[model samples]
Target: MRLNAENIKGMLLRYIVAIVILAALFTLPFWGGRYIVMLVMLMGMYITLGHMWNLLAGYSGLTSLGQQMYIGVGGYTLAVASTNLGLPLVVGLIMGGIVSVIIAVGLSYLLLRMKGMYFAIATWMFAEAMLLIVATVSFLGKGQGLFITEARKLVTAQIYYFSIVLVVITTIVIVVLLRSKLGLGLFAIRDNDSASATSGVPQFKSKLYCMIISSFITGVCGGVFYMSQVWVQPYASFSISWTVAAVFIVVIGGIGTIAGPIVGGIIYVFLSQYLSTLSQIGSLNMVILGVIAVAVILVAPKGIVGTVQEKFGFEILSARRWLGKSLAKVPVAPAPASEAERES
Candidate 1:
């Protein structure tokens, strides 16, 4: 695509904004107090989780309601590997992701058989089953959860930096994938799997790729989360709230867009914090959040980022501007000539 001067200016503005925001975030620890830094770290964690969910449900058309399966498993894996087995914390964290990947590979065949609601239901059931199973395991604290040993020595600042690193890694991984041919194929499958397959897009493979990538990232987030807290339990790890939070963030921020999760995570985290401090309404934070989500749905069905892009032509994570090429590049077929014209 040809870039006019106006387009060039817009691209520069987007890049500048992105860079400035990142720079501020990375430098905040130097000036911000412990409480503020902790809040930002929590926001980054939520953003990382939300991004993985968006990749699978928003971009790959796999709406899973059992993502907590990975979360619980990852947390427990780290607990066992690092705390019990006496492995390095880093190795344990890596183990968490590896375990999630292995399980996802096996689950993909079964889960991929069902589509839409069926798939969602299956995933939820799987998570529930896992919760029960983990509850019965004697070594994993028997539902009481396990405390992370190594992380006990780490201070708040150290954990905050770890969260920042995780967010950066997740964001970079997502951006790189979205700019590749595989991401284009995944997008095709998300829009229309049958059409994608007809166009040789490898629909199953693309969906599988999304699942593996999403699960691995989510698992890592889970590990980091429990490590920072120094505790992990089945109920909290496999809670339905994880899935709900991810869905709420993505839906409110713009499900299909890259920057949507970041926007949603920030809004959700801050709003939750503010609402919880109110004596009269603190207990009803979920209710308040639900109402806000409903309002967003009614007025801006495409979500906050989606609506803004539609109205103002602003897209922070637009691949078109970043890659200097249109996102969907399907070729136009040539028109057939009439018989009389062909004779000439």
Candidate 2:
């Protein structure tokens, strides 16, 4: 009873803190300058990206090296739809997600067959192929890129709001999904696929669900990011750097934890920005970031948030099931009578 009460109190406290933080973020643009808003906006996008990647690798055990494929597809879809097809930016955004889902479904047949490094490599190859196709396709602006003139009409504040909403929605979806039956199945598969399969967990279906959700959200994020940039180039959109960034954020923040990506996104955005200003170091900023990641891995192993939770035994966003409480709720069957009692 005491432990359950403590858990409830902790959960309530977490909710309150989350609400306060979200409120501040929503109102930030009103008081904060354009630069700050833009920075936060970028942070939100990367956080969403990290969440999707975490869903795949950390939860579903799908270590994809080519999420950029969805990003590029989303960006290109937005560009073509809005620029050429004369659709609204909102419609284009939706189209981007839809197209990515379709593509994910098609590729899942082949990609899902492989496991480990083979799956990762196949994803990367597919992304590279997409880049080449976009570069060669004349309607996609060939090697140059397409300008999202419509996006230019929207102000920074509006874009910031969009980013904020995306972050909130993405976070909510992940939390709710993690607490559902599908989420339980995903956890099972992540721990051991063969065992999960034997236990009657739908392995392919669960993974496919994760992939589809991740791809759709990632696609939408890509659309929003490129929309903010007002341009989309094949090379930039399809760069492996997207996957690298997601990996760094998740690993540095703490893989398999909801709070990990959020913390990692903040650290990444600020650190990258600060590093970019150091012209003296030139392009060595990436190297510095890599070193930091290595240091974190060596020291904590589980990441900052993961290490903290392990040592302290608490979670900010607790997605784990309370085994004691769960079992307590299940009705126990009466024990069988002893042979002597039965005879009596």
Candidate 3:
């Protein structure tokens, strides 16, 4: 659409607001306490995970329950690179993403052949198999897991900065992708794969692209998160809880929208931190989280942001491209008269 004055103003306003928010986040460590910094760090990491999952399941119609596999691979890659190969943690982080993409490429041939529940189950099984394999492998520290010794030299603030960068980059990548031709193909496939395929959309290629992109970013995010913890174990790294957290964040926040994960991540982190302190709840925090997710689904099936956007026409971060001006410029033809009216 041709840019109207209102559109221009709105775009400028959004840019200004984004810049201000980003500036504050970048300087948070200098002003915020250690606890707050750590909290935001967690929020960033989960938001990245949530975004990647949303891209796959929401836009591309690929509901994977094995994203944690990439997380584990990335974590182990980082650990081995730093501890055994004597490489910089930064290089290890990049390698994590590359390794994940490689694995994703190999898995896509098999997993992409399946659909719906079968696909989901296959992904989960793959993750579980990887967990067992890593546990039994002697070089990967066996069942004990490997330590990210290089991460020890880095402080919380540094790690927090890394998390901030990762989240920012991930968000940008998603936004850009959604506005591209590939994203259009993804949406078409999601709505109706058969129809999209008939219309000449490369179904397999689009799905594969989405899966590979999701895996690469997810792997990098995992590496960054484990770097903060300074440890990587099979059980912890390959836990199904990672996918569960992603689902909760996306579902509760608004699965398809850009702003859903951000809103959901904040809510999840806040509730998790608060619930963890409740002696009564103890390890049942996950149970409480599950309850809250169910409640959200029941109350607002589209999620908080999605429902609001649907009812109020308010989008916190809209991905729509308006064609109002272009459509307006087109000439409309008059309707043909009926036989009786023409005779009259």
TM-score of each: 0.89, 0.93, 0.93
What are the runs in model 1 whose C-alpha is more than 4 Å off? 1-15, 279-283, 321-344
Model 1 worst lDDT run, 10 consecutive residues: 321-330
Tens-place lDDT per residue, model 1, 106-135, is 999999888999999999999899899999
TM-score between candidate 1 and the true structure: 0.89
Give candidate 1's root-mean-square deviation (CA, Å): 3.7
Candidate 3, residue 289: CA error in Å?
A: 0.8
Write model 3 residue lDDT over 227-325, tens digit each, in one string: 999999999899999999999999999988989999899898998899888846544988889999999999999898899999998777666755664
- lDDT of candidates 1 onward, in order: 0.87, 0.91, 0.91
Worst 10 residues of 2 by lDDT: 323-332
Candidate 2 local lDDT, residue 240: 91
How far out, in Å, is residue 165 in model 3? 0.7
